[model samples]
Target: MRVFAVAEIKFGELDPVSIELLNLANSIKGDGTAEAVVIGNGISKYAEELAKYADRVWKIEDSSLENYNPELYVDVLSQLFSKEKPDIVLVANSSRGSEFAPALATKLNAPVITDIVGLDTSNGIKATRYIFQGKLLVDILVKDGDTSVFTVRQGVFKEGSEVGGEVVDAGIKPSVTPKREFSQIIEPEVGEVDISQADIIVSVGRGIEDASNIELAEELADALGGVVAGSRPVIDSGWLPKDRQVGISGKTVKPKLYLALGISGAFQHIMGMKDSELIIAVNKDPEAPIFGVAQYGIVGDIFEIVPALVDKLREIKG
Candidate 1:
């Protein structure tokens, strides 16, 4: 059995999340071998690096692909899968990977395992995932042919040694570019430290209320000397930027001190952030699910509670 892992290449280097997936894929090694696909304008040359973690490195190049076009990439990747006939296809659960994996699975009529933590092929390709905000681990068997599409969560695996990254050519052909109706690819302008790896995160949720109320969370974050983040609704409502949103839909952050203000934890939201070192939830509702994973729980209104906490924290720090 052979596995196809998608290579996430950026600025000529492999994305950290892709490396993490390769490590996990390598761990459950048996008769199965792991390879990766490097897709970009000039990614064929990076076969050496991809070969460090995969048995074979399939590279595709086209100047048109320099900028990501979802339609065009799906076409190219689908074509590669047609001929490769690997036992499994593994993709990183990043933005582009998430979009392509499901669509490709639909076309192949193959089973898909999304945001999965572990896998077992012994029982004909069974996989497991975290359910109820990592509160439970549910196991499910893959339903379909031997081919399965696995989109792995980004932080599931740790960085490890570069082992089977040997570069064998995939020998795949490129198809004619489809007329792209996409307006244009616009990379969002960002100038902040990546919150996903921050040592401490002070995030606000719906309980904080309107966008104007954000200052309350900001002040507390400042008092703690930590970074600020928000839930999906907060970022989608433009109270904060997309990069600032935490949980599965947004960036999965694992901070040392994760302070959630007024955010009732949702399953999709908490699965990403439940790995923090210390979780402190400040929600008035005592039964809020955020308390389930939080190391410290404060059932009180943020408006009245934060000022005192900030002042006390400052005094203690001094």
Candidate 2:
């Protein structure tokens, strides 16, 4: 198999999902070539870093490609793939990837399997992706000897061992005129805490009852030396800021310890924090879906359990 993985760059640095894409490619490539393709204004450093894992790194740098343009990305990648004719093209299922993968597939006349969470190569290529808002998992099969593009979900694959490779400059330039012009990037306002980076997170959900009741979760988070976050419901209710929301629609997090309080564990919420090292869910309903993914489960009312847990943690601190 000949595989080509696209490396995504954000804020002048390589996106972490780029490494995950490389890892996925390397795992399935076997003895075949696993190449990394990076396109941006100044991505030489990222290309060099990717060379440690990929069989070859193709760096496409140009001043016109400083920011992400869907048309330009599709144009450049379509041209490059036309020359290379890779059997498999791997892309991260990020904001940018979601925009261009389908268009690139159309240009290449290949099948595109998006948001794939699992893959089986023993019997051809069978990819697993969620359907109906993650209510079910469906397997998509690709015929042998066929070219295809796959957008892999983030945090699904582990990082592969680094094997040194060579870096080459891909001199392909985009000929397509972008329909849109590059403008200033409007960054989101920084909140009191970035839950994505928090080591320990205490997250609440609709089960939290009311906005005023959020203090219980806050106190518990404080006692545990963690940051407070919430599910979409709590955020929508104005109890927590958008930055503190954890779900498919919000932020993905992989904290060392994730304590879900009063969370019912919708699939969207599970998708965001399922990669956490340890998950502990506390909800009164034993059948709550959140407990399915949690390492530890407590079927009790948060109003009663949170205060007890906070007191216990404070006693331990003393």
TM-score of each: 0.72, 0.85
Candidate 2 stretches greater than 4 Å from native: 192-199, 215-227, 236-238, 241-254, 266-268, 271-275, 286-289, 307-318
lDDT of 2 by residue, 1-318 (tens): 888999998777787788878888888887788899999887878988999989999987788998999999998888888788898999988888998999999988899999888776666888888777666779989987558999987766654789799999889888978989998987666557657668899999998899899899889988988999999999998999887889776777888899999899988889889999999999999999998999999999999999999999999999
Candidate 1 lDDT over 1-318, as tens digits, reads 778778786545667777676677676656667777777776765667767877667777666667666666677778887887867888887778888888888877788878887778776777888776656879988775857888887665654567755665555545656666546555446656567757788899998889999887888888888888999889888998887878866777767799999899998778778888899999999999999999999999999998898889889999
Query: What is candidate 2's local distance difference test score?
Result: 0.87
- Position 149, candidate 1: lDDT: 89
In terms of TM-score, the best-performing candidate is 2
RMSD value for candidate 1: 4.5
